[model samples]
Target: MTADLGHGVPEPATTAATGGRPEGHLGAAGPAPQVVLNLARPWGEADPLDLAGAALGAGLDGVTLADSPRLFPDCLLETGRILANTGARLAGPCVLSLGLRHPATVAGALGTLAAHHPGRLLAVVGRGESSVRNEGLAVPSLRTHRESLDRLRELLDDRAPELRLLGAASGPRTIRATAARLGGVLVDVGADPAVLGKAVRLVRAERPEAEIWVFLRAVLTRTAAEADAAGRPVLGSCASRLVRAPDWYDLPAELLPRVEAVAAAHDYRRHGTPAARGGAGRSPETERLVRDRFLLTGDERRIAGQLAAVRGLGVDGVVLAGALTGVVERLNKLATAVRAGLAIDPAVRTGPAADPAAGPAVRHRPDRRGRNLSAESEE
Candidate 1:
């Protein structure tokens, strides 16, 4: 049973609380869709040991090791080992910067794991930000990123290991390209229902068979008030991330300034601010629009409603960003609520979570521009 993306496209409904069919295409009798749990940020100093414990306890399906090189060097291998040891689902760490430099290297690292793990890896990609830049690398444009991803797939040689590499894109062009080249697109930029609908429509127009997932900040609070309070930072954090780099998500150029403003105000170091990185402020109009469009704060039922709204728009799955508490506890709580509400079985694990090509399909065209670019991505 394919889920209707509220637009004309049909998606598969799932029993899992994370909700959705598999990341791959859903045939008439395809198996269940896997719910991907992304662990992009550190849950406030929560140790990896504790994080694993919480995930195992909550019954998550998978985990995505983040893009921070300093934070996730051997950490990826360690996390993979832990998840495998615990009998939990394991997705690739899939740090995006590596792909920016060497798509083959990214594939090799993950491909080696897929070969070993066999059926437990899901590869996710993202637009590297300050972290990527900090490493002396420039963020790849959507076009370049898509092309690189296609190259990585070519390098894979259809191994069909337990892995599926997904591209992170929200812009129309990227979405269309993703539908053209890769397995799916995970919209990690804007959580707005309208934006989601637009993305799905753009992708569906081309690859009607592509998968679309929404990554949202979620809190299953004790009450609506608590949920709202917890939700503020999640909203601000997203705004901060997007406002700084609107192009990453293919946001409308007009709305970019607005997002940047709100992000500036919501400093991670400041009290009541979401724990996000980047510089601060913008014009009043830009701030207001960013506040209204990107910030999503509310209760669980409300969050679920917001999620439903997004679902109605076009998302295949909701990678709920759990509350910002200590890592272990928060992951535990998130896994419980999201899994329960989405009807996910206790047995499933939530692993981490993202493109394309064109006419004549000129493959592996040496990127003259990127060749000179060091690993450090420009902002």
Candidate 2:
């Protein structure tokens, strides 16, 4: 049963919330999509143990820490604390930039962690966006980036087969390249069912064996009022992340001007913050449109609908990232609100909240040079 989603994309209606693999794809029908938390900042700088407990209580499958070495505490150290404290089967650096550490050293560290915990370690690699840029270094070209991950994959496999390797891609070329080189892809494409479906198809087309995950800035609240109260950061995320992939999903014709303004004003340097202003017009209309497209806010019903829409697209999982404030609170809220609503069942016993690619995720962003970068990217 196929349903048209108005954007020339079709979704498999029967698959909604079933966690079933999409048909006609080459990848193994793995477990249902997982819900993992990739910490942008320590849930208001909360203790890692408390955060791990929050994840467990929320029925989360995994947890990942953002790996900006200088801006925050060591992600691996935080990961160790989470692993030691919680029963979570997935945890690690959401993205460890290749520029900061040699793949061999990283592989060694994660491999060691996997040896102690086993099947619980996962690694994501990117061009080292904020971290590298902070040091006044240039990000790696796609070729060098992929080659480095390829080596990381080789070393990881030799040390711990259970460990999974993923990449953060900024466009379709990177998505395709990531699908070919790594275990999975972390995408920031739009959360529309059609867009999710398209991303799934694109990754499987390149490497049916690969897994996929969506990176979203979400906070599922108990009330609309609560959501709106703390939604500024989420709205900010829309401007920053979505603006990067402006073409990933179609904006209403009425909102194009505001979106363009957002693109023009997007702050590439502070791209990860909830306060990042990617240039969206200040009008309530623009904020609403951007909010509805990129964020998961409001009450439980709204959160469920969005997660269902994402899983409906046959995605294997979602990575929830948000502001430093109330992150733990939101994760706990997701356990109750999202778990109850979506019936999220993470099959991962050890690794893979699992993914690492997409249709021009996929908002196929236009770089400074105006070349379309296709991805649900980070950075």
| TM-score for each predicted model, relative to the true structure | 0.66, 0.72
- The per-residue C-alpha lDDT of model 1 at residue 136 equals 56
Writing each residue's lDDT as its tens digit, candidate 2 over 1-379 gives: 1211122222222242222223322112343556777766523455555565566556676678777765556888888777766666577887788878888998888888878765566567787666776576887877778678778877877887656567876466677777776747887664566655556666766665466777765666566555554545445545544555556565455666776565455354454554555443466566666666666776666776667655444455667774533556656665566555444333322112123222212211111112112443443
lDDT of 1: 0.49
State the local distance difference test value for candidate 2. Answer: 0.60
lDDT of each: 0.49, 0.60
